[model samples]
Target: MWKIYLLAAISFLNGTSEYVIAGILDKIAEANHISVSSAGQLITVFSVAFGAGTPFLIAMFARMDRKKLLVYALTVFSVINILIAIITGYEMLMSARIISALSAGVMQVTVLTLAAVLAAPGKQGGAIATVIMGQSSALVAGVPIGRVVASHYDWNVIFIGIGAVGLLFSVLTLFAIPKTVAEKPVPLREQFKFFMRPRIAAYLLITFLWLGAYSVVFTYISPYFLDIFGMSNHGVTTALFIFGIASAIGAQLGGFSTDKWGAFRTLTGGMLLHAIALLLFPFIGQFAFLFYVLLIFWALAAWSSGSPIQFQLISLAPAAASIVLSLHSALGQLGMAGGAGIGGIAVKNGLLNYLPWIGAFTLAIAVGVTVLDKVYLNEKQFKETQSTLFIK
Candidate 1:
């Protein structure tokens, strides 16, 4: 249990590295004398590297001892952050972001797998959820903290602190985690087979679209608040704090709702709420009280879908749980990348106010995909169809 908590702490660090950039997008842009839209590309490239590079990297190192791999990845992640603290060149920063993303992805996946392997029987799900909480906890605490710190001192200080903590956690991981035997590696081809199934592919697609819609608005939220509502730094921090808390609550609700209502029901309803919230954002900016309510609502609705999405994926193909999970992570990040990139394009074209509408449109497509899967491509439906054909 202590070990699981420690792994969660490590995940919190990795998540901070990935997410804190959004909190300080304007600061980084001002420092480099670039447009905020250009700064947003930092997010796009990091997501691309993480989404495109991680699964293969995991597959490449599949047979390595999880304990050792975790420690190594954490060390590399720490060293990269430390370097970023000192390096200021734009190209250099981009290169560092790529390295950081890959290391963070590997560290997260290894920790998740290790958490399950180390937990007692029947407790694996709780253990994995604990680790996920660590990541979600980052949004609640880490981003607001970064925003406050960057307002007070150099933005680089946040990364320096993360690097120091990461190194310390790596040492803790080395001493605390027990040695475990490696399982046989699943081939890339074998994993690809599960993806070929209609239901499996549609679930993954929904993850991409759902998260992509989230990223479209959220990737530029800092500037959006500052520019439109004229929020002070303190106000921005407060809003983000509220948003983060809502996100954490939403994740818990997602898992609960999945258990209570089943995955499809929970997912479709959550996603509908998510899209509606975004679509309403453009119209609510003038009312301060309503504005904040909508922000919290948006965060809650967006994150509430996460657990059910994963639940649906795993339920669809239980034998390939790990593979499906890895694919889910990859697609989720790619969705974020696509969203951020599209938002950047819109921002560059002077369409900042239109971002929420664009995000709503993307989520609308995702909702449709979910409905399509439930009606036409679900496994139960396919099985029934096969039986009917055989009877004829």
Candidate 2:
């Protein structure tokens, strides 16, 4: 359990490094003598690298000892961040971000896989949730903390801090995590075939749509708050804080619910609630209390399904757990990117009020997909059982 918590801490460090750049973009741009839009490309490159590169890395290194790989990845991740802290040129910063993204992607998949394999029976979901909580807590605290550090010192200082902590945790992970049996190296061609199965394919679709629904609204939430509710900067910040806290709590609750209620029920219930929460955003009008309550509930509902979704994917193909998880993680990044892209289109069309509705509609489609997949699976299992009984 303590080992799981330590993994979570490393996740927190990794997540902060991933997200804090968004908060300090202005500072970074000024330091590098680039426009802020160009500065934002650092984030785009990181996401693209993480989403497109991690699965290959995991497959390529499949035969390496899990413990050693994790340690090496963390060491590389730390060293990259430290290098970023000392670098001044835009091109150098972009190059460093790519390396950091790949390392962070590897770290995330390895951490989650380790948690799932190391947990006691029936506790895998809980353990995974604990690791996710680390990421969620970084969202809650990392950006604001980055802002504070940037206000007083250099923005690059945040990376240095993340690098220092990462190194410390690399040592901790080396000492604490026991070595596990290495996965047999799967050919890249064979690994891509995992996506061909119908159920697995459907599950991946749900992963994309579910996170896409959340990101569609969340990516543009500050502007939505300003345009729709006329929230001052302070007010928007306060709302974001609440949303972040709810998301963290929702992640922990998701694990508990998945363990207790089974993955299907938890997933179905969470998605339904998420859709309902978003669908009501426009109808809720100008009631502040109701708005805030709904905001928290929306965050809770949006996040609570993460553990169950991952649990289902792992259950689908335990033999290829790392491959599936890496793919799932990659798809999740794509989903967020897709959502943000779509939301940008809406905002460009002057459709800010409709963001929630678009998100809700996307979630509704995901819910339908989940339900249909469940029915198909149930019928298939029943037929298989009947055939066995008949033969007997």
Candidate 3:
């Protein structure tokens, strides 16, 4: 239990580090004397690094001891956060951000892998969720706390705080996490080979599309509330807090649902709900309560899908769990990269109000893809059943 808490704390630090920037975008821009547009590039850089680095890092470190790798990653993450806090120029800050992102990407995969391995049979969902809840809580609490810190002090304070937390977690991880050697080292080529499967390719596509659509609107949410709804910073924070709370609930619910209904059903239903909520965002704008309600639904449905997706991929490729999970993290980051880019373009091009429309459209595609996946699964199951009956 203490080990679980330690792992979750590490996750919490990673999440706080990843998202603290979002809450302090304006402050960062002002402090650096740069345009908000340019400052937003920090997210772009981080996402790119996370997307491109996770797989490579995992492949390169595959043979290394898990405990050592985790400690190294956490130390690097803490150092990068400290660098970010002290960096003077935008370029330096961006570079540090990328470094931190790489560490975070690696940490997330390692932590999840560790969690799954440590869990008893049939408790993988709960184990994974225990750590992931940290991320969700960061969304719920970290952003608001970051905003407050940025507003009251310097934006750098956010990174400093995150760095301090990372340092603490690093110590905890180093001491608490048991030394576990890899069962068998998977070479980089073998890792890449997993993608050759058609079903694996389809699942990767699903992750990409689903995350892309979700991040599109989520990336721009704070600005959307401020610009369209005329919300104060407090209001924006409040709204995000509400959304995060809902997401945490949704994540818990999702873990339960995955165990009961299976991954495909949970994913399909979650995607459908996400699409519906996004489509309704514009309609609910007139009423604050309605708008918040929709936001809650959106956060719940969208955030709940993550664990099921992870569970499904692991089930699909049990032999290559680490590599497949690495790819999953990379693809999800790619989705975030795509979404943020699209949202930024839309907002810059004076299509801010139409942002939710893009989310809706993208989600519709995701739903279509999910439906296809279901059909594929059902047909495969039926064929297997027929073969069994014939043999009997």
Candidate 4:
């Protein structure tokens, strides 16, 4: 139990590190004397580093003791965040953000891998959900709290506060986690081989599309509320709070759905719901109540896909769980990077209203993938049946 909590704390630190900037972007831009668009480069750099670093680090460190690697990664993360707190210029800050992202990427994959090893058989989904709750909780509480800190103190203080929390969590993890090793060691070459399987490639493609679509609109949600609904800061904060709460619920629902319905079905349903919500966003802007309700649904659909995808990938690459999970996370981060970049370009080009349309198109692709996945499953089943009959 203590170890589980420690692992979850590691997740909380990663979540805070990932999102604290969203709440404080305005303050950071003002303090650095840069345009908001320029400040957003920080997000882009961090996400790209995170995406690109995950598979490499996991493969390189696959044979190391998990606990020791976690400690080293957490220490690096804490130091980089502290550096972010003190950085004075854009270039330096971006450098710190990338370093922090590398740490975050490794830490997240380690936590998930550790959780699966710790869980009892048949409980992998629940275990993963418990740790992932840290991310959802951060969306619920971390951003709003960071906003308060940025409003009352300096944006630098927000990073400082997160650094302090991370240091404390690292200490807890070091003391609580038992020394552990991978049950089956996988060579780096073997880990990469998993991607050669067409099924695995399909899974990765679906992940990229799903996350790219989700983040595009989600990345600019604050601006959307301000421009479309004329929402004040308080209103935007309230809506975010609601969205976060919905996301937490969605995460749990996703876990349950995966256990009950299997990954493909759960994914298809979730994507369809997400598409509907995105399509409704533009039209719902006139009704504040309806708009907030739709945001909750949107969050639910968007976040609920996570556990199913993670479980599917881990099952597919059972011999190299760590590598597959790391790759999955890296690809997801790439989706975030792509989404934010495209969304930023759209906003800059004065096509902000078309953001939801883009999301709709992405979700449509996801739906198509879902349909293909089902068709593949059905055909596979039929072939197996025919083979069994011929043997008899």
Per-residue lDDT of candidate 2, residues 1-392 (tens digit): 99999999989888888777655665776788875446656765777788889888987787788888899999999999999999878899989999999999889988887998889999998998789778778878876677567757888899999989889998988889999866466687877798897677888889889988887777666556766887665676577678878888898799899999998899999999999999999887878999999999998999898889888889889988767876787888877667766776776677778889999999999999999889996578668889999999
lDDT of 1 by residue, 1-392 (tens): 99999999999998889899888898889988888899898899899999989988888998888999999999999999999989978889989999999999999999998999999999998999899889889999999999999999988999999999999999998999987766788888887887778888999999999999999988898998888788888888898899999999898898899999988888889888998998888787678999999998998899999889988888888987888989998999999999999999999999988899999999889989998998777767779889999999
The Cα error of candidate 1 at residue 293, in Å, is 0.7
TM-score of each: 0.96, 0.79, 0.89, 0.89
Task: Give the C-alpha miss distance for residue 33 in model 3, angstroms.
Answer: 3.5
Ten-residue stretch with the least lDDT total in model 4:
182-191
**Which window of 10 residues has the lowest lDDT sum in candidate 3?**
182-191
Residue 41 C-alpha lDDT in model 4: 65
Alpha-carbon lDDT of model 2: 0.83
lDDT of every predicted structure (CA atoms):
0.90, 0.83, 0.81, 0.80
**Number of the top-ranking candidate, with lDDT as the measure:** 1
Number of residue pairs clashing in candidate 1, backbone atoms closer than 3 angstroms, sequence gap of 3 or more or interchain: 0
Ranking by lDDT: 1, 2, 3, 4
Error of 2 at 305 (Å): 1.5
| Model 2 misplaced stretches (Cα beyond 4 Å) | 1-4, 21-44, 65-68, 82-95, 112-129, 147-155, 171-181, 226-236, 256-262, 282-287, 318-323, 347-353, 376-392
Best by TM-score: 1
Cα TM-score of candidate 1: 0.96
